[model samples]
Target chain A: MQTGFLKSSPKIILRFTDYNSPFLGPSPTVPTATTASPSSSLQQPQTWICFSCSYSNFASTPKCELCGVKRPDALTSSSSTSLSQTQISPTPILGEHSPTASLGEVTSSPTLQPVVTSEGISCPRCTFSNHPSMVWCELCGMELGTFKIDGMELSDDGNVEKTERAQHVKLAFRNGGSASFNNKLKSAMTDREWEKITEPISVNPQTDFDPVRGGISGIMKNVAQNQEEQKETLDQAFKDLDALMAKASDMVKLAQSIKMKLNKDSSESEVSADDDSTFSTYLLELGMSNPVTKKDSGSIYHQELARQLAEFLSALLHKHKGMMVLTDVYCLFNRARGVALISPDDLYKACSLFERLDLPMRLHQLASGLLVVQAADHNDDVIAKRVLEYIRQKGSLTAIELAAIENASIALVSEQLQMTVSKGLICIDETVEGVRFYENIIINYQWDQQALQ
Target chain B: MSAFDFPSIYNFPPFFTQQPNEATWQTQAQLWISIILSYCRFYKIHRLDLSDALTTELFYNKSINRRLKLETLQSIIKMMIKQGLAEWDPPNKKTSAFIYWKKPEEWATSISNWVSENGLNNSIVTLYEIAHGEASEGTEFHEIDQAVLLKALDVLVKKGEAQTLQATNAEEMGVKFFGTG
Candidate 1:
């Protein structure tokens, strides 16, 4: 029953039965109780079949079985009847109820398998791919000492070496140094808890630990000192500001007092004093009279001051002819006092008196005109004739020009002109430019004209 | 000699002071009013500048050292305008004033009457000959400022007393007195 010198094994016997049961081929022999089939041995080598459903399979499979499909007779035959006849010359056959051929996809090429890495895996922490024998994450200084591969540490010596103090210090420095280490130590042991606990036992020739607690205490002392200094500086600044404000307020009050004094006195008298005081004190740093301390000693001084002021004012109006700036008069008033006697209010009163007495004052008129104080009411005909002759000679005379000629004020010239006019000897012509007195009686004197006729 | 009578004691200095007092000033103004006008007419002063030298002698009289300022002169002139004794000439500040001791119309009437009385009415007269020439001899029209004579002539022309014609010289104009009465 052997074919081509290949012996049929027991395992090949099932494949032979599976190939014959389906639509792959008509059996040259059928499985029967009556006879042991010799051709069945030869047919096992030729037929490839489905292991699951007894269908014909391909020859390339290592073992004959239903791979993925479960149906009987689901394997494909290449459709070569001649090769089938050669392999199974005396073929065993299955009955007419055998299953159909398979419709599954097939290809000749095989799929590749996955390869395992040779070196150690990259660390999830620092991503440094180190040797599997190493017990720590090298780049990030992570302790991988506890790793158990098949219930044993990867390197016993490597784990032991890491526990040494020098190695720990090296790693600590690399991981943000002694400062970070101290912080971590402090966080782990709070101040209260550390106080309750025993101090660390001092070891000789220690590099990492500063055996005394001085470093931390020194840092805390420096921070406290800095905070104290800042507080002192801020307090000093506030003190300076308060002093400046006090000075400003004092100045304001003084100004108000002076103003009140001016209101009570005359505004005119204050004007001159104000100018002189400012000039004298321009570069001075002190004694700017504070308003709070000015003493107003009632109205007695005011009366005395007013009388003197009136006299002074009356004199000035008689003396000066040009427009007098109020400030000049104030300076004179302030100076004449043996002491700082007149208040701003009194100063103001003096000016008002001057202004009020400008008109209706007989003294003012005499000062202004041809009538000398020596002869206020008298018309000095000598002066009148002189003026008349001068005008007669000059044809026109201004107030000043005439005053100069007659050796008198405009007041006197004005007086003489008025007297002359009243006597019907002259007439005045006034215009926006100036006044001119004409000889009316002299022109219309009629004696010569009457004689001519 | 009556003008020599002194009215009161002359010791008051303010009497020499220019009266800022309006009533006193007004009285003062009125007094100077007549004096200035009369003096102007007496001197034939149709124009007055009121210079310092003139004011010195006229108002002060040199008996005292005090005098009126240029400002006082201006104030007096302003006062004079109120009384209608003076009119300001718009073109000249110093020269503007005209004293109307007699109005322009009256001067014109006086001239016409004089011409008629002299039997010279209806005569064609050269303006220069009438004002400055022999025809004006011993008359008020003699040697008048040209402006004043023209103003008088214009008044006469308006009154139908005269007519004017341009003359050969620029300033020599002619006047013809037309009225017989």
Candidate 2:
């Protein structure tokens, strides 16, 4: 089958070139004569029946000469059979006449001849029917065979020579992936396998009945079909996204219900110590169903954020021993909110509103200028007393040792020890081993007997 | 003396560190002053070299691996000068100072008592004899720093109880004590 198509392909090219010679400007006739005689030996009938309108066309005609429908087997069959005996006798005379006679036959069936040529390799970029021998489109200059022409324009003057101006069409792929598409197109062109894919579509009778075969109406039908397909795909994607959103909400609700059950169980008895309750509580912490957004709390954004932060941190502050670094709070709060993460400046501004809003959690700045979120009840005196007691017990304590003992940040411990020093409860010893704090024993020494004597 | 007994506070690591607080540091300065006076008195040390003192056990505690900084020692010496317990030896340079374990007036009272007890009132005594002569053996003034002896004699002269006679040589420089009337 492939060999027959290859053998007939040159004759098909000769016929098209001879038919197009008027616009292409008169080519040599010797090669045409040589190619046409052998094609005549293929013994095609003088006339053939059109499947669409059932009109009998001469073997030299590529389309239905009566109704302008393309012949289905034009690629493989070098020719088609005649319905009447009168048409059959003229086949031998036409074959002897060859190029001039076939050209005359093509001119006779001239209505849709230029628009839909059977053997012409169409420029996929501009839908211009190019002579099969050209590697690039004469009108568009795009590499031939990069795309298969989906439809053709049916006009009296579909001739490329009639248009004097050079028409340029720029294809811009706005959504990216153009490089990959070009690579695939290049590979398809290189393999020359697109012909096989387009051959079946051209022969399929179902596609022949499609209105997109030719004319302005065909283009409108093609566009409408494409839009319908796009709408279907978009609707499917939105439906999947909606289903996923619903599942997420369901999961949140399930977590809330489990948390509620755990709370109730713990209130009634002390049996809520299992891993399931702990896991649920963890999930509950992660789910901040309603975060205070700037959009939702306009004008008083910082105040509202402060309130929300206080509520979020009250429980967390207890777990962290009533103090957490401002940066840590920002991370935890943003993670819990899951979306609409706040900037550090916004978090800082919101924390600044804690005192104005009288929130249970306050913003505290250490001597080192590090900001922390501290509980309202967290007092310097308490920390100082704790440090003093620890220092008294340990004889002397470095900031690092106290930080480890209290499981608090070194900055906080250092600040606490400094406060104790100011209060004269403890004194600092700065040395090569770093600063250490000791009980202020110098304050209680007897001045008279110890040195004045 | 019997290996000058260091106070219990000397063993404290923080005691070697200069205190940062004002009131605490004043107390710490006093403690340092007292320790210095007794340490100097026990060792009969009259002059303190700032740098040399830092390496000694007085300023550096080896077991605690801590040492008083030079600035801290200098400040402490300045406090001692303010208290009249010390004076810069050359009267201007700060690197070394004369530690006055006993004020010059107290030293003068000890010298006058020694003269009255030995029947040497109205008698002329060479400054060198008061510091290193056999007659001054087993006395608090024996082997006294020459500069300190001069200061003590100056106090006596200021009191009109003694007069210093200038001599061609410092060893012959004498102070005549008047009987306490």
Candidate 3:
């Protein structure tokens, strides 16, 4: 499309197919559509204006007889090389129209008739209006219809009802200024919008509601609330989906890891495909949607927080070393509870309550006063033996280096080393590089000598 | 000549630092005390100057990349004094210490045996002759400190096994061991 060079001439039908687009820009032109929608000018045929002579020609004629300008070929794809030079975007221009529709001769098949278009597609070069069938402008030889990227220009006539309900959700959220107003707004907007969108929840909630009565807490309460809020946000997305999809990408990582893990152990679980549908839905529910909070837990806040903390940590311990730094625990616990954030003091109190209970995991404070959570069955002596072996090999190394060896945190490793020092398994070395630990060969050798004697 | 023996624990890095824990500190102190005594005995170091040994390889362990901090070194020396393995010279000033790797009685036994073995019993010998004479060659007391030699002679004299010569000059005093004490 040397559209710039053809500026002086009448617009040419570089690709005659632009006029045959079923729907171009904002208009849907199918004559057989359910309604006699007059939205598209292409649906009706009319006179074709001569682009060069400024002479009006009959719709039946493909060219200007007086100017001897031959009719341009019906629209076809533009040569891709010069697409950017064409003033009208190429993909939106050609749309779905076919070349046969621009042929002047009548076809025997009922569906082959040229789509009668009154609304002339403006020439990219000459500013002249051309009939849908004209492959090239009568005046300029610039290509008429080159743009045709499918799916980008689909008509949304079918989704009108769905989109309207999504709008009502937006209105309600905007009107919610106060907390009570917001709550009411949430309930009011719940029906129709989300109900229509998520006819796909398909799977029932798998968690047993009764067996776990650490009391339902606020997690369940947030679920009903989430349905309303989630739909409202999605309704806002109906207005623009591109941004929403970008934001949703982060939510894909956890699902991918879970999917990878499931694929690795697929035979071990034998879970049905239906279970997987809810699994993705559960991923969307992440700690964000179902957090336990003071508003819901009330009198049993600390107690419930403690139990939830224990349950979460116990599961984590299976993956991590049997311990987590107190600071890390605070962050993860709060994240698992979502909007229900707890204060550090509150976390400490919640942890203290564990001492009074018979839980398997307890908060441990090291000799240096560094705090961590460790399982009751977890043994430091085992780590000590490993530390002893490690020190003997490296001769001596720092806690940070040992952390790398054991795949644990520096804080945890440092505390473990201190305990080993107390046990006389290894001894600490304070050097310029930092503190390192070495095998307590003195004690062992002394004992060995005594045994020999 | 006997080989100088060093305990294997000297190569350990932490062996240089005094432990922070009470029980560990006590054990490390005892280890250091033994190491110091053995090292002195091997080198035949009669007196240890705290100022000089502070920067020596005897205190700073390069293999372990650690050094005995001044505080830890002083503490170990004090523990040595408490155990009678060492005593501070000019007791109040405490600038240097006399390491008693061998007790006075033990030295007296060796000196008495050396005199009898060399047939020098009942024959008076000047202090210098006893300290540096050919008869003293290959003996542990060959190069014994004068103060330590005098102490050993005092032990023999106290037992009535040797007589101290009444010399006009104190420096020329000699001793006669009756027989192998």
**Model 1 DockQ class:** incorrect
lDDT per model vs. reference = 0.46, 0.69, 0.62
- Which scores higher on lDDT, 1 or 2? 2
Task: Report RMSD (Å) for each prediction in the order shown.
Answer: 37.2, 18.7, 22.9
Lowest lDDT sum, 10 consecutive residues, model 1 chain B, at B1-10
Model 3 agreement with the true structure over A137-255: per-residue lDDT tens digits: 65686545422211212223322222222211222445656688757645644432433322222111101111111123334645767898999898887756656534444444555
Q: Residue A56's C-alpha lDDT in candidate 3?
A: 52
lDDT of 2 by residue, A67-89 (tens): 89986553223122211111111
Worst 10 residues of 2 chain B by lDDT: B1-10
- Identify the superior model by TM-score, candidate 2 or candidate 3: 2
Q: What 10-residue stretch in candidate 3 chain A is worst by lDDT?
A: A202-211
TM-score of 1: 0.30
Error of 2 at A195 (Å): 60
Q: Between candidates 1 and 3, which one is better according to TM-score?
A: 3
Displacement of residue A424 (Cα, Å) in model 1 is 24
Candidate 3: TM-score, chain B only: 0.86
Query: Which of the predicted structures, 1 or 2, would earn the higher TM-score when compared with the native?
Result: 2
